[model samples]
Target: MGLFGNFVAGGLAGLAVDLCLFPLDTIKTRLQSEQGFFKAGGFSGIYKGIGSVLSGSIPSAAIFFIVYEGFKAYYSIYPPGSTSEAAVQAIASALGAIAACIVRVPVEVVKQRSQVSLDSTKSSLDVFRETVAKEGYHGLYRGFRITVIRDSLFSLLEFPIWEQMKTFYAVYYGLEKTAPLAGACLGGVAGAISGFLTTPIDVAKTQMMLADSDALATKMGLLQSLVRIGGQGGLPGLFRGAVPRVCWISIGGFIFLGVYDSALTYMSTVAV
Candidate 1:
């Protein structure tokens, strides 16, 4: 499929998956919050920041797929000498993640705060306004760098594994195309692995974004925040919310990749 096809497919897939699993995401965010899950509204208002996520998911996902597919196409033509297919996939995935983070970071900042908001009545708009008013426009992107790093790392692991698994399946079955069900299963496993492995980075990123303007976490770098988390809570602390995150992303990846493949297949046939 073409770049536009990728964009549309990815946007729709992201929207579907995000909306379907938003509650799990909220739970995961709260679990990773500095205030602890109970203090971060517990089970109440899991949909708090959905507006912000809804607004950003499509554009960010669209941008990612466009860049990712475009890069893969380019790499296929140019053929990076001696680089393994896994490495090439990793490079494309990281670049796509980096590009996506331009929109994803701000959305995450607002969405996380909203997820952990003390007041159930507080709207996402309120969080956005408060963040800007208190910390300027930059507040919306407080964890931009860390977010990019985390997502790039995640993509590096996830995309390559997912692709490799599909390749294996195709080769074994002698199939010309991978079914959506196979893609979903492989994507889920890859996402779970990546999500679990990256929990520490995600924890630090969450703390960084949720930190108050003058908070120590806000002032400290990613490494410092990670060290501090490890110091206070040990290994378990670093992996806090890992279960929910893995569950959320596993389900989300299944849906996202399945829908993307299905949509792209349909679009390709339609174009023909």
Candidate 2:
């Protein structure tokens, strides 16, 4: 597929994956936000707001992928088929991640708010209603700036680190055919590291966007939340949701890379 096509394909794939497992994402967020891990049955706990989360991820993924791919292809230094420099690859990944993050901030602002029932207002439908009622359309986009910064960091670490990790695995395993497996492992590693690093920021962002209640209002605004978490939980508070996010995204990455690589290979074969 061409760059745009690849993006559309990848975005659609991400949407599907996210939709199927949105409940995991919702649970993970709530578990992180309030330690609501036991609120649901065993494995099913990860799926708290599957319905609401879907409303956000499906369209968001497609738009993000298109933006990321467009920026990458346009700004890349080396021509297609050249020996890509590691530094260049890193820069490209960062750029692409930034682009994707910028596009995605709004969706994330919506998703997290919809996921947790910290307040009586949860569910995408209700969250949308409440946001529109209170904050208007722009209210739904609250905390988008922080969301971009936070997820941009994820993009920076995830893509470049993933590239390096996969390279290491492919060389170490000496099985070109198994590179997808290697890539999946690398994706997991990158997601884990990035998720932990970004957890506090994620928490703060979520807190900011959630529907305003006296409880939440008293709880913390953006700056105050940062201070409270820092004072009490320290760095750990920020990463409260890391474990589940890492696990959730890891499996998603595995499935994503598996299909992505397989698709690429088939495309190459047909082109040849």
Candidate 3:
């Protein structure tokens, strides 16, 4: 599919998955919070920071798929001699994730803080304004570095695995067309694996994003955050929200990638 098709498909997919699975995401965030789940407002209002995600997910996902598809196209034209297809896909996915982080980090900061807020009346804009007032505009990007790292690692695993699975399915079934259900199932598996492995980094990212301005975690780097978490709660602490995260991302991946593939296929036929 073309770049514009990628953008539209990605935007639609992102919106669909995020809106549908926001509650799971909220649970994952609260589970990873330093104050623990119940203290972080628990299940009271899972949609608290949805506004932030709603505003950013489309553009961020659109940008990612555009970059991803664009890179793959470029590589197709000028093939990298020694690099394997999987390696190329991983590289492209990581780059796309890094690009997406420009929009995603700020959204995450606002969304996560809002998720843990005790006051249900606090709007997303209130969180935005409060963050800026207390920590300047930079506060919106509190976890930018770690977010980029975490997402890059995630995409590195997810995209390549998903693509490989689809390849295997095609070879096995002798099918030329993409099947949405198969894509969704494979994507879910890929996302689950990626999410499970990346839970520790995710936990650190969450802490960094939600840390108070004067908190030690705020001053700490990603490595430092990981170390602190490990020291405080051992291995389990590092993987705080593994269950919710895996569940959220796996289901989200099913929806997100399946929708993207379906939309892109429809757009391709229409363009023809």
Best by lDDT: 3
lDDT of 3 by residue, 1-272 (tens): 57889999999999999999999999999999999999999889989999999999999999999999888887764433224777888999999999999999999999999999999899999999999999999999998899999999999999999988888787789888549889999999999999999999999999989999998888888899999999999999999989999999999999999999999888988889
lDDT of each: 0.91, 0.62, 0.92
Clashing pairs in 1: none
A best-first ranking of the candidates according to their lDDT comes to 3, 1, 2
Two-way TM-score contest, 2 vs 3, winner: 3
What are the per-residue Cα lDDT tens digits for candidate 2 across 60-115?
A: 55555556556566657764323464455555555555665544555665566645
Winner on TM-score between 1 and 2 is 1
**Model 1 off-target regions past 4 Å?**
77-83
| Per-prediction TM-score | 0.97, 0.76, 0.97
Off by over 4 Å in 3: 77-83
- Can you write out model 1's per-residue Cα lDDT over 71-140, one digit (the tens) per residue? 8887675422224777878999999999999999999999999999888788999999999999999888
lDDT value for model 1:
0.91
Worst 10 residues of 2 by lDDT: 39-48
Q: Enumerate clash totals for all models, in the order shown.
A: 0, 5, 0
